[model samples]
Target chain A: MLFEQVNNKVVRAHVTAQSPVLARRGAMLGYSGAVAFRPVRGQGGGVGGFVGAAMSGESNPMMASEGDGAVLYGYKGLYVTVIDLDGSYPLTCEADRLLAHDANLQTSVQFVGSGGVRAAVRGAMTGQGLFTTLVHGRGPVALLSHGGAFPLQVTGQWPVGVDPQAYVGHTGNLSLDLKAKVGFRDLTGRGSGEAFTLQVTGQGTVYVQASEQKF
Target chain B: MAGPSVFTAQSLPDGDNVNPYVYSIGLAGEWFISKGAMLAYYGNIRFEAVSRYASVRDFVAAQFASPVYVQDWVVAEGQGKLVIGDRGFDLNAYDLDDGNLTIKASNLLAFDTRLALKQSIVPGFVVLIGTGRFIASSNGPVIFVEPPFRADPEALLGWADCPSPAVHHDAAWMAASFAGALQGALGRTSGEEKQYDFTGTGTVLMQSSEIARADPAVLRLIEDQTRLLTDAQAGSLGQQLMARVQQR
Candidate 1:
């Protein structure tokens, strides 16, 4: 793995000439050795990723860092988690959640509502926009979240329900559907604060943070 | 390197903390959860607003006695592992075995249905009584201190098994400077001059940081208490409040 967790809230990525690092702009806490950071526009998914970011309102301005040293990365005091990708399952996440990742990984835009209009509505309710960033052929992807984030294993038999505000990312084959638990009583009274929940079906892992605070 | 723990539907702990900022409540029957506190849940569970649930469930009205907090709490029922968190604050669950704990309303996250919640006489606080578990959040790690001490109002998280703290003023500081005296006379002292004085035997819970969230119920509680004041006094109080706002 190129990214090693220095602490719960920080990650140290060993940067090399061959394996450069794409990191969030202004997230470099510090670095050692000779590392050069250049602001790169639309660095994640190329042309398609740029257009998707504009359309999806999920813009993540990244910087390219390359040198022969270790670079420390952190953002907004958020906790960091590194997911190792074996080129099997693509990691789906919001662009802003991406802290740092191997520049060798392939990036593309994926529709949050891969199932059409109904899924689009779910995506809107999640406040994550219509398109999400998909990292393919990743060596290691670093993500940030409030408090910290943990993965919940999802199986074919048991589905997991998550609050959209707490969702960080997911890996493997999974279908996300929005379930509204609202009823007549909810319409009448103050209503349940948690009226909508994101249901993850199929098989994979869902990453969620301890907080429901919208970023 | 090892990352955060991975939890499954069956592996989530029962009424235990997943981390310092997250708590997992294994639910079979019911729990009184603060509104917007839940992060996620596994299995079958339903969250009903206390206002709506009070009409259907007889016990809701009996357990939740603070009307001001009705809008901020919900009842989660059924079988599931409910996860809750508060704005990245340090969270801890305390067990109250037939005891009472008065806590800052905004800091008290969730409580058991077996415990009864009552509005504390202290404006912005609530008391939980009976044998059950409840979760609370603090800006930092909670520090346990004893009685015969004075605490800054913002730093005081809560006091358990003790009479409500009395307002304490630093008389020496008040008399130290003319400007300070003037501010105190105008009821606009630097906020460091006033404190909560605790006496008797009890544990006082304090957060390492003084930052705290404003309780939404405080306005209503203060509004409700206004009925005791005469109209002239109320008018003067309004003027004072407006002056304070203007100064800010």
Candidate 2:
């Protein structure tokens, strides 16, 4: 496939007449050859298309490209990360983190909110929505972060705690629960902003980037 | 992409940057970290309040020497790998060997206990004395410049082995722009008119950009310092502060 990572922070997609690519809206920097950038009508019109947007509030604001030409996609200078998939495990990602994915992959909104538990709002404090997008049957999925993300392996014996803002995504069967350590200082408005945390457990790899997305 | 480097507790580097924005600490005992900077961790690490932790009371007394930072800091103790991030800024680790460095408090992320921290004479800055390792974040990659250079206050990361700085206002520009008015309500001046003039032999660290760190604790720091004022002055200052708050 000619559509590959040009560098650690940019992606170069080579589009052919038969092979089209989907990208985030306004992510095109520059392109050459005969290319057409059009809105993917109703997000390709399928079960995981419009339904995913309405359910998860995941707005692709997406655009599709066709024709025999190469296109470049980049975010707002964020470090671009390309993750190659083999259809072995499904990858879950934040809706805004999606850059470009293969045409074969299916995107859907997956509910991860707490079932009436107030604390388990699933990244509510960090400005992440309750429903995150899931990508499967993929070829390559590109992610974005302020810098690149660091992947940490989680085991059943030990659990991992992550700051809500820095969390990017994860793969495999993982459960996240909120752990707030409210100190006496919170009453005086001097509380450590670190009080809210996401405790992750299960068998999977959790991804975290360096910069917290401030709402 | 075949894969990026996968890090585990054992594989994460000790006291190093995992990426431009993330720092990894191979912690065994304890480290002083600014609240909320921690991103994630592996192993049995517990973060305890600096003001409320009874077990750390003596350690706090013996090690922590700055009261201004008490409310914003915590002691993380345990065996494991800890990762910390600061709002997407570039993270840099500096090793102080029997030397001292002063940094903007908001940029400080974590420091080893071996270093004694003291409030700097300059407001919003802290001085670290002794030998230890510390992490600081900047809006961009830090640029090292020698003395005889004036820097924008917002771009300055810190300075090592340098004496206190003096404010350098461009009198020429002030005269040109504001008719030489130093304290005029109507004087309109560019933010660049003021700079920190540095001299002597030392290294000055600056970020590439002028983006400032969020300083929520500055209010508290100013509140603490206002205690040194007389009652009459305090009352007048209180009214001014109230007016300023309302204006905001």
Q: Report per-candidate DockQ.
A: 0.01, 0.02
The iRMS of the candidates, in order, is 16.7, 15.6
Q: Judged by lDDT, which candidate is best? A: 1
TM-score of 2: 0.52
Chain A only: TM-score per candidate:
0.93, 0.86
Model 2 DockQ class: incorrect
TM-scores, one per candidate: 0.52, 0.52
Q: Give Cα distance to truth, residue A184, candidate 2, Å.
A: 55
Query: Model 1: clashing residue pairs?
Result: none
Q: For residues A47-163, what per-residue lDDT tens digits would candidate 1 score against the true structure?
A: 675666667666666667787887666665577889999898999888888989999997777766677887887877766778788899959999988768999999999999999
lDDT of 2 by residue, B26-76 (tens): 898889999999999999999998776635458665667777788889999
TM-score of chain B of each: 0.91, 0.89
Q: Per-candidate RMSD vs. true structure?
A: 16.7, 16.7
